[model samples]
Target: MKARWIITAVSAALFFGGSLLTSLRDPWFQNLQRPDWLTFEFLIPFIWIFVWACATISAIIVWERSSKRSRPWYLMGIYAAIALLTSIYSPIVVEFRSLIGGLIVGGLATVLVYILAFLVKPISQKASWLFLPYALWGPIGTYLTWLLIQLNPGVS
Candidate 1:
């Protein structure tokens, strides 16, 4: 009950912060060699808002669907891992200015998104479905990181 709500609130807050991990206005980011087709910078925050909203709702659904006899600590841990991984990605890339680091973190996050979706499916199909956007975004983000690495070689 109350605990579920608290967990949901915390998840939402953490993901909201994760959404803002990368700064579009940062000089380094602004100077990156982006592809001409990548023109949706302004939509990133909104896209993350939608993704995190889905993730939050999915977590709640999973929580409600779990049996009282067996608490959903595993799911909680997975969610926390994914959220934390997502949060640190931008900082790591920005601080080190390393496209390689970004690519690694992004790929890892994508894998975790798939793992989360797979784990959630058994608990609640609807909840798993809710993770679809995040799952899709994960690969897209990873691809973007890889592209950046390709565009800007020798980026330390």
Candidate 2:
């Protein structure tokens, strides 16, 4: 029970931390040309909250279901990796103004999410389902980053 609490707290912290680290109003971000079809900015926060919640639940499911196996740790490692990569993405794009860096990280995230899902399937199908939103969102994020790169040639 205590371990579950700890994991939940840690996951929440990572999600919130990653979210708080992103600032889309900065000058660099403000200067970038948004795609004409990019109308989802308003919904992004809500979508992320949903995705993060699902991810947390999925992690907990894995923790409980795979307690006897080594897969849990490896699975959690991938989660942490995705979190770290995601946390760095905004900083790379906004702080360093590197769209290419964002693209690289976002693409890797997309790939990792799929792998995470694949690995978790044997442990718990329900947990794998919970990751559906995140896995789906990954490509959207990667494509957004790619679009940013195409639209903002001035950014290095």
Candidate 3:
């Protein structure tokens, strides 16, 4: 139990810090011409709050739903998958500046989270809690993607 808590806390911190660092340092991210509606300065804090809140709620849900016997692997797998997919899609979505493409990727990711929630039947309710913020962010991200496409129509 103690180890699980430690792992969760560490993982959450790493994920949050890594995201912040990337946003702060990535040239492509910093140089991109964002739409008027998409403000990075404001979005960063919002994203940080959202990520931490989701992580906390998800950790609680995992503790309540899964046993020590299986929780670590489950949590690790979920977080890893999310990180991998986001890493792959984020740059492409930004670089390509395609509204449809970004929407497809973000939409699929959102759907996958919902699907995972259903698959974990015993914890589906709590899983929904874990993913609700992400789900909400998906549409906002899609909107930003669309705006990016509008702002940089020639990018691809």
Candidate 4:
């Protein structure tokens, strides 16, 4: 459906564009005592593109599979929550420059993803499964961010 693609496109754009617009490659980021494993800073955008792709596909499936009566609820609840979490992650971490704060909030976001994954499984298993990639990225990135923050403690 035209509307489905439009919804997916808009959500993907907001998730990816909003993240890309965050304070990236700043002087502060450059100076962080990043670990050897964190060397692939250049790979973040690509990773995010992949992650958002999964999310977009999952959104389409979820939207299509939801019953007519429940379609609006899925859009407003799961989709909105996903959008909020995806959009806030970078800004919150960048604003505080603190892994502790990031861990707390990012942890919540990750859990919400799992919750949504479970909620959508009965609607569409593929939709639920698609959340896996997005969920997988969270902990690894959170840990790497933790390492960076711990190694470079000057910032709040």
Candidate 5:
């Protein structure tokens, strides 16, 4: 349906748009110490694209199948919270250069994604599974962020 597509597009746009607005390029980020295993830096954006697509689709599935009163409020509240929390990552991590802040915000984002996954399950199992990748990846991201913070003590 058109609504589903619209939601997906808008969700994707909001995520990527927020990234554009908040993302910063700095020598600090570039020069930060990373393990040899963490060398695949070029794939970060692509991974985010995939994760957002999955989360968006899952949210749409939940919205379509849930009660009529789920729109622009209950669902939107969760979605908005998720978006806002996610958007907080770059600013705190890059702008303020706060390691603990990044960990906390990233941790919150992970929790929100899990909550989104749970919210979709009452609607569609398949849709719920769509968020699985993100759910699975969130902790990994949080861990890596923590490690990066630990590994690089001089990023600020």
Candidate 6:
């Protein structure tokens, strides 16, 4: 029980921290190109919430199935890998700002989340819930990335 709580808390913290760190790096964001509707100030908090929500839900599902030996770690690894990829590519792609590129990244992220859902059978139904929030954020992030690219067409 206590271990479950710890895992949940840690997972939430990782999601929140990763989001916060990314927002803080916005000033260093390389491209000026953005859709008129896509403002960093507004979008950052939204992304943070979406990311946190996804992590929270996923953690809860994991906690509920704590008895499973390999499932929790597998889920954690999947989410972490996806998060890490987002963090790494976000800055670079945003700096370069291209619609097609953003689309590809966004599509990949969505597919990965879906794959994660299928991979974890222990809490497939509940875990499937987490994927929606992740999916929602992927498109928003992709849009922002596309906007950045459009605004900075010359960014190489």
Best-fitting candidate, scored by TM-score: 2
Residue pairs with colliding backbones in model 1 are none
TM-score of each: 0.90, 0.91, 0.63, 0.84, 0.85, 0.66
Ranking by lDDT: 2, 1, 5, 4, 6, 3
Question: Which candidate has the top score in lDDT?
Answer: 2
Record all residue pairs in model 3 with backbone atoms less than 3 Å apart, i.e. clashing: none
Better of 1 and 4 by TM-score: 1
The superposed Cα distance between candidate 2 and the true structure at residue 2, in angstroms, equals 2.3
Better of 3 and 5 by lDDT: 5
Candidate 2 deviant stretches above 4 angstroms = 68-71
Pairs clashing within candidate 4: none
**Model 6 whole-model lDDT (C-alpha atoms):** 0.61
How many angstroms is residue 64 displaced in model 5 relative to the true structure, after the best TM-score fit? Answer: 1.2
Tens digit of lDDT per residue, candidate 5, span 1-156?
577887777786678666776664666666778777987678877787788778777777777777776553576567767766676677787778776787887798889877767766767898878877778777987888888878987663
**Displacement of the residue 2 alpha carbon in candidate 4, Å:** 3.3
Q: What's the true lDDT of residue 97 in model 4?
A: 65
Cα lDDT tens digits for candidate 3, 58-104: 65566566775766466546655654454445444545544466567
List residue ranges in candidate 1 displaced over 4 A.
16-22
Model 5 pairs in collision: none
Better of 4 and 6 by lDDT: 4
lDDT for model 4, please: 0.74
List, residue by residue over 1-156, the lDDT tens digit for candidate 6.
465577656666555555554443555453354466554565666665677566556766765676655557766777767665554454334454444654675667667877886766456567677777776777767666666656666652
Clashes of each: 0, 0, 0, 0, 0, 5
